[model samples]
Target: MPKRRWLVAPPAPSTFSARFPQFPPLIAQIFYNRGITTPDDAQRFVGMEDVAANARIGDDPFKMNGMSQAVERIRRAIREGEAIGVYGDFDADGVCSTALLTEALKKLDAKALPYIPHRINEGYGLNSDALKDLKEKGACVVVTVDCGIRSLGEVEAGTALGLDMIVTDHHSVGNELPRAVAVINPKQNDDAYPFQEFAGVGIAFKLAQALSDAQQQSPLPNAQTLELDALLDLVALGTVADLVPLVGENRTLVRRGLARLNKTERPGLQAMMQQAAGKNRSMSAGTIGFFLGPRLNAAGRIEHARTAYKLLTTQYPGEAEQLAAQLEATNRERQKLTDEMTQKAREMVAALPPGEFILIAGSPDFPEGIIGLIASKMQEDAYRPAIAMTHKDGVMRGSARSIPEFNIVAALDECADLLVRHGGHAAAAGFTVDNTKYDALHARLRNIAERELSRLELVPTISIDAEASLSDMNWKLLEHLDQLAPYGYGNREPIFLSRNIMVKSARLVGTEHIALVVSDGVVVWDAIAFRQKEALPKLAPLPKQVDLVYTLASKVWQNEPRLQLEVKDIRVADL
Candidate 1:
């Protein structure tokens, strides 16, 4: 742990409610801080629906990039009764995107099968052999979801075989886009879609929307009517897991999507819920990201992601239950692997120069599939740029985690001359490089970090909310905070900084927890700091007062409800 720095947050702004008349002062202040200002915006923020309107269906279909040709090509295949296959990636986003389109096609009475490549065995995105195999299955058209943006060679192979492909993905496009019939990714250089922050599932949903609109407008006899809304559950799961900013259309989709998830009653979800007993029926973002998403993701991490996809979209209750349980068990196994690998990676990085800005470690058995989780854990432990790698077949594959100050993908781009492939956002990314170049890559990366990072970058700081009095620690205050529900990666719970207070009593409770009863004349607050038992000797005997920055939360002990404060940082009072 590092030494604490004491600083007080400014008082709450007065424009909290005046600017947004719909919210209570506290809720309004929270909304204002979170950047939701107008009444219309606040309403949409809470309810998730601003305007009830369908997606825009482009006219002069040929004017849209590749879509017109792809759709017409697919319709011809259906008329000729040619088999069609859907290929997907192996992550939550990929699974949902694949399932969304498959369901939409099924609803429209089209015969389409799904195929997801294994993460460990097949790696990411589309591949040459996989496309050829699909083409051999009597398929004339192939649709790809959440992948294929970087698969130029694979697309060309299918095109040469007279196979048309429609690519729906959200990854950044390479210099050369795939020659697929229609590429629906918003990141494409020629794409004009207004929203660019969609997750892979969101892109797939947009295609479904467009397909439905096209069907509705067609004058052909017995034309199928498309239904796209049925896939929102998958969209919400994928979008939130992929960590896209939940604002605008994304926000509306997730807000309503979570509601649908709670009452989902889908055979697959119900079976998963039974496997994960004791969970609340009213699922929140935490439930999806922490509980469900991980279990679904575990199949990809340790084995193949197809099991998770099948579990989500399966109709057989028995098969769903068995698959969901298998996924739950796999997640537990994944936790053990990640924890061990993370610990080893940390020790390896710690042996390097303590001031090194970038923490890079690798091994032959680091488990290629879970390097991302290991990198994230290492980053949390060291608060630095982290990369965890695994070497196989003369190639090194890895995942990188970075802070807000550093653009990891850009850093990789700077080193692209050495990398075989790399792509992702600023905070996180994935890459592969030749094993022979590993040493030079390490040296170059460290050099870049040394020049870029400063001393302040080593230590992490907690952001505190407005200063409060000990009197403010009460049921009412805690209840008021509940309005900020559905907390997760983007929207976090509030952290309050309380002024001068005395430690009424302090003791070591659990093996490594410091329990404190702090008091001001107006109120008393119970506080706890995990893994801080050593602080008890100094804090318990303190006669002087203290100032603390903390977060207010509810603690239930033996079914008894009580207010508790989580101390973020603390300092002895100057007075």
Candidate 2:
């Protein structure tokens, strides 16, 4: 294991309040410290736009390189009464897209069947075998979501069979695109779409919006106009789960989608939320991403992904309950496997050469489904690009996770000759390599990380928003700070660093948590540090002065509400 490093952030601006007069002084200071400078930027995000106006199509039809052509193909399919198929990816993005498009096509009187490829067997993106099967199932047009940006052979198979295909995806494109009627990916250089960072479901939702407008214009004979609002719940689920930037159109979708989710009568989501014990509160993106997304993904990870697709599209309450129970059980199993794999991965890294920039470890027991999670854990623990591999089908398949400073995909591209196939974003990626060449690949990856990551850049740093006095932790300040809701990936909650606070009292609470009483000479507040019982000796004499970085949160238990400090880092304050 490598030695740890700490990078302290520079001090916050002293003139933050004067610089931003629109926001309250405390709020302005917090925002400025977090690098949010402009009033318009804060208003657009923190205000949570009243309506997702960007979702609406213009008086002039929405134009892109292939949007019109894709819409025409689907319109022709509806007019001809031909069967259409939607081949989707396995993740939340894929499931939501499949559901959204299926419902939209049904309103247009088109028989649109959904097909999600199995992660374990079918792998990601399109496969020629699946296309041939869907083609034989009486489908005339095939639309792919969340995937198919690199499926040239599969598209060729569909085209050779006289089945027109339309691709609505957001993954990066390779050198050659599939021979589809239209490709609606924002990442394409020729694409004129306003926003290119949309998740797969985002692109699908925009297409649904455009199609709904097209239907209103022509009013398909004997067809009902589709309402797109009902699908926002799925859009929100996929967008947050995929960790796409929650700004611009993505923010609007998630904000409006969360409101819809609170009232969502979707049987599948309701059943899962109920089983997870989160049905009582209003659904937030945090609940979806942390509590619900993992359970839904567990099905696809360990067992068959079809279980999740079935759960998402299920109409019967009984069926949804049964699938939700299955998903819950699978999630428990997944947790156990991941825990075991992570421990083994840590031990393997321990045996490596003392100081390596990258951690590349492989084991046959590392479940392919959970290796991605294990890789992510290593990256956080070591603050470097980490890769975890498992020998599957005589080949070494691995998942790579990188920090913001390093581009994992581009790093892997440098060693493309050793890999069979690889494609993903800058931070996270996946690839397959020969088992015999694993050693060579690891050496090459370590060399790449050495060149890219400097010693100072490899540390996991805590970013503090601003220094504050204990008296500033008031209800109004906490409430105002919460306007920055739905924080993840890009937008993060503010963390404040304060010094020389007295520890008035301390005790052990529950089994592993520590409860504390602290004062800033103005007021005393109650705080709890979960799983910090081991740090009890650090405050043995009840120090009069202490320093810590924390976020303010309100905790409710047994209907009793109180403010609490969620500690991020702690150290002795210099008096």
Q: Residue-wise lDDT of candidate 2 within 1-575, one digit each (tens)?
A: 33333334555465655766766676886666566777776676577445553455222226556888888889998998899999998777788788888888898899997898887787778878888889899999999988888778778888998889898788777777788999888788877667777888888888888788789778888688687888888888888988888766787788878888877788988898899856576677778888888987787789877788888888999999999999999999999999899999999988988777888889889888888999998887777788998887778889989888898988988888898777778988888888877778888988888888755446666767767888888888888877877777666777777788888888998988878888888898887777667667788787557886778988778888789897766666776
Give the worst 10-residue stretch by lDDT in candidate 1. 50-59
TM-scores for all predictions: 0.87, 0.92
After TM-score superposition, the amount by which residue 456's alpha carbon in candidate 2 deviates from its true location, in angstroms, is: 4.4
| Model 2 ranges with Cα > 4 A deviation | 1-22, 33-41, 52-63, 454-456, 505-514, 530-537, 541-544
Q: What is the Cα-based lDDT of residue 334 in candidate 1? A: 95
What clash count does candidate 1 reach? 0
What lDDT does each candidate get? 0.76, 0.80
Steric clash pairs (candidate 2): none
**Residue 466 in candidate 1, Cα distance off native in Å:** 2.5
Q: Could you say which candidate leads in lDDT?
A: 2
- Model 1 has an lDDT value of 0.76
